[model samples]
Target: MKHEMGRSDLLRRIQEVEFVALDINLYLDTHPDNMEALMDYNKYVYELDQLKRTYEMNYGPLLNFGFSPSQYPWRWIEEPWPWEI
Candidate 1:
């Protein structure tokens, strides 16, 4: 099923992704030989990429491309900050 997540929900998802990514990174540090954890980490990375792309497309770019604007360039411009929801 498809989800029609709002901006706040999307941000929350991104935060979850960040936590999962960090957790996976720490897991890999200790269990570097575990193929299952590595696979899961790869999957999480892919999901994070998708989330970031969706966010950027709707809200403006988040990271710097070689020829693009730097990440967080307009950090002060207020939209709905994450806590507003």
Candidate 2:
């Protein structure tokens, strides 16, 4: 993330984190006593949020709720959708 990454790269990282979290979540469902797995799940979820915010700030809302009042008009609509990239 230190180096400038393309939009797709950031998107991919977000997916990677989510994927990790999803697996951990499934494991925790069966092994509810695994505190370590719970911690990891929280970590990945946090990372995913950070990445999504960063992407949305520079690009636009990833979801309808991602809008953060902007001084420059509602330019979120101008940005190309993720798949359009």
Candidate 3:
């Protein structure tokens, strides 16, 4: 019973993962000695990377300013703005 995620759904997932990773990052800033927290942070970061890659592949680049490469015809402008999503 696997469900395929749509564009917005995938974007939401990416946001959620990003949030978790950031929260863990802040926690680690004060508790750098916690190995478990560090491991969880790494896991979430990897997941975030994969989700971002998948989103770019299915839709378009999630960023600009040399952060993401665009195909011919300049896809960065072609895709909807972040607010539109």
Candidate 4:
């Protein structure tokens, strides 16, 4: 089932995923032999993938997929204006 999340909520979630990915990436870089960190990093990566998929499926694709999928011609539209939320 899909939940109707506000644009701000989606943005916040994506930011969280980015932060976790960065943290895990840095940990792995410094402690390459740490199995637990590696596992956590993998988990975070999977979460990030899922989050992206959810956002794209619910809203429009966050990044261009090389071709447009919208029924009408599209232009870059900013997410709900920052102040509107």
RMSD of 4: 3.8
lDDT of each: 0.71, 0.77, 0.84, 0.68
* Model 4 regions more than 4 Å off: 1-4, 65-85
Residue pairs with backbone overlap in model 2: none
Ranking by TM-score: 3, 2, 1, 4
Answer with 2 or 3, whichever has the higher lDDT.
3
lDDT of 4 by residue, 1-85 (tens): 3346676787677778789889989988889999998888888788777766676555655666664343233522646433344
How high a TM-score does candidate 1 get? 0.72
Question: Stretches of candidate 2 above 4 Å error?
Answer: 1-3, 65-72
Give lDDT tens digits, candidate 1, residues 1-85.
Answer: 1336777777788889889989999999999999999999999888887886676656654544442232456642445544555
RMSD of each: 4.3, 2.5, 2.2, 3.8
Best by TM-score: 3
Q: What is the lDDT of residue 50 in candidate 2?
A: 83
Q: How should the candidates be ordered by lDDT, best one leading? A: 3, 2, 1, 4
